[model samples]
Target: ELKAHSEFRFESNTSLQLVLKRGTAEIFGTELAIDIPYNFNGVKLAVYTYHGAALEITGETIVEYTSEETPMPIYYNLHLALEQRRMLKKSPRILLIGSGRNTASKILANYAVRMGRSPLYIDLDVTNGSTLFPGTMNAFVLDKVVNVEEGCPSSTPLSYFYGQTSISTNMRLYKKIIAKMATVLYKKLEQDEALMDAGMIIIAPKWSDSVGFEILQHIIEAYQVTVVAVLGNERLYSEIIKKNKNEGVEVLKVPKSGGVIDRDVIYRRQEMSRQINRYFYKVDNEFTPYSLILNYKDVSVKKISEEFVAPTSALPIGATRIVDDIRVVDVEPSSAMNHMILALSACEQTEDEEAIAISNVFGYMCVTEIDDAKQRMTLLVPCYGKLPKPYILVGNMKWIDHQ
Candidate 1:
């Protein structure tokens, strides 16, 4: 089952079943548990054993006998460095920045847990629904090892509603939300000594090539980022280094995995829907979401982009709105937001725009059935008939329930 310095690599067409039967082995720098059968398929992963040992391999899978080099060890070294800093009581807040799906923030966060650090993992990618779910900004402290097969458990993460996928759709609102989330995180760090000392690890938003640079700089300042981990982009690395004028901030370029594939829009949307459903109902189908019917007048369903006054129109001497010169596509809740996800806001109906922007969300609801005739909308809520808050915000996000 095992040999000295032996490597077992799997092919895309086959699933591998490896049970660590003997001495010692590691996959992607994380040690394999003895007698545990790990199932992996269509992934670029390797099982390596030092000084021999192994037991069972039973699966209809092709073993790829290729000599491919990966930079996973280099990333492990970065984790080691951060772990060292944490041990010495110097808090380090790391932010992983890149454009696309290839950014291996997930893997890095897993590695940090493997190295025994309770890093506060923040996911800013609302598009793909990687960490918690789509249309959410989430934070979870990694106190234990993460599962390779599934996302971080729903109970583990504290999620906030961002209400939409793309940052470009509402740039002004997105910046405000991010800053607010950072403030919340700092407050959390103050209470939890271990997580605070271990510091923050953020999976940066998926930024476009043109506007990504400026947004990256904004996030750097927002989080007071100690380290900016740039993945696979030379131009971004150079630009970040040049733009980062802050002292003691290190900009490091990390390699992207060759196995990372780009997901299309439809695929991402489907994934997002699955994530939402999973939050309300687990994969086993035993859980049922509450069906609530609420009158339109009872809840505030105004779009974040709804401008009472046009941006170009003349305003009073000292009056300014959040939407001035900011590009935001308004979502008409009564008509356009049918089948869309709505975030229940903690902010009151009379709260200011900035207040609503930073307010915490209680839970999410799918505008399942809207009846304009009766002025009522049916919502699929997580709990049983309990509306935590009366104010809900709608975005330009919709879910097509295939079920």
Candidate 2:
């Protein structure tokens, strides 16, 4: 004699779409498919038989199965329960870092809310308090905020990926602070084995790039958790290709021109989050419109003139192309020089004396025609004095095509 039983458990309201198979004993089976409603937990499958002479429920046949449900609160609960069963367990700590904006912070916060988890949000680059606490109306709460001092000693090593400068130096310090914070937070989460088992360490940089990517690498090494990178910039995407050429870092890049808060993007994320919630107890939601905004053609350069004279004071010593409608000149590093150049470039020559005085202090100057073309001007500053490598800066005006 043999006896077999199958049991199914439904954690959420879900309908099982099934196709039944016929058995040799002439046991009839019916196929059913339906959408299980939400919040309906637990269900079972049983087998019964009816014959001409006898009606009977045969060999214990109960199948316990679980439906795929969003992992948010439920996942956290399950994780907590599982941790309690283990003698030694640790909950991982998550750190979400983004550019000094509330977009990334809010998205991550929403994910935490759905998962019944609390997260810490830090605004590393807050020029104004606007993007900080009490952010935009749509911003997410339930996460702590930490504002990094503008000028502080860095705790992490500096990255020379981009040209070295005072700003880059400060960025290194910011990275260190984040790494230290991650370590401290991880230790705290590890205190309770149950919490540890239920905890996860996550860090979502505002966007990936030379600076952001480096910061992400630092955080990954510091906490050693799974990384879900949300790329917003093409530069950042390039960095991922170069860095993780062969490594497995689970980098997710939103399609080009994809805005962070666009309706389509939000819907796509909602569906993705729902699925992730079903599979993982914790999910990270950090999307930004960096790429979309960067790719927008809304802003264009406009020309202010066809032929104009550049203020003499704005011309560099070696600049000989004076007759040319537009002349690009290199200048020495001087506050006065920069101010004068900016003024001359803007065609505000009433302050020409002051501009000249500033120009004398700086090593070079240039004067160009005042026209709509000037609006699209780009200044290329060489890395070395009179060297070939140049760093380009677009003028403050929009480009207008003369078609």
Those runs of model 2 whose alpha carbons end farther than 4 Å from true positions after fitting are 1-105, 120-169, 193-210, 245-248, 255-403
Cα-based TM-score, every candidate: 0.81, 0.30
The TM-score between candidate 1 and the true structure equals 0.81
In model 1, which regions exceed 4 Å deviation? Answer: 1-67, 99-103, 153-156, 306-335
- The digit string of per-residue lDDT tens for model 1 on 179-265 reads 888888888888988887787788888868766777777778888889988887898789778878878889998876544446677
- Supply candidate 1's per-residue lDDT for 162: 71
Per-residue accuracy of model 2 over 1-403 as CA lDDT, tens digit each = 1012221221112333322223211111111112221121111222221211111222232343322221123323433432342324333333333321233333333334334444333333311112211100001123322111111111221111111111233353344444544555566555644344444424343443446666666655665544333334456556665775334345543321111232244443333224222211211223211101111122221111122446677889867546333222333322221211121122222322222211111111111222232332222111123212122112111111111
Instruction: Supply the global lDDT for candidate 1.
Output: 0.69
Q: Would you list the C-alpha lDDT of every candidate in the order shown?
A: 0.69, 0.29
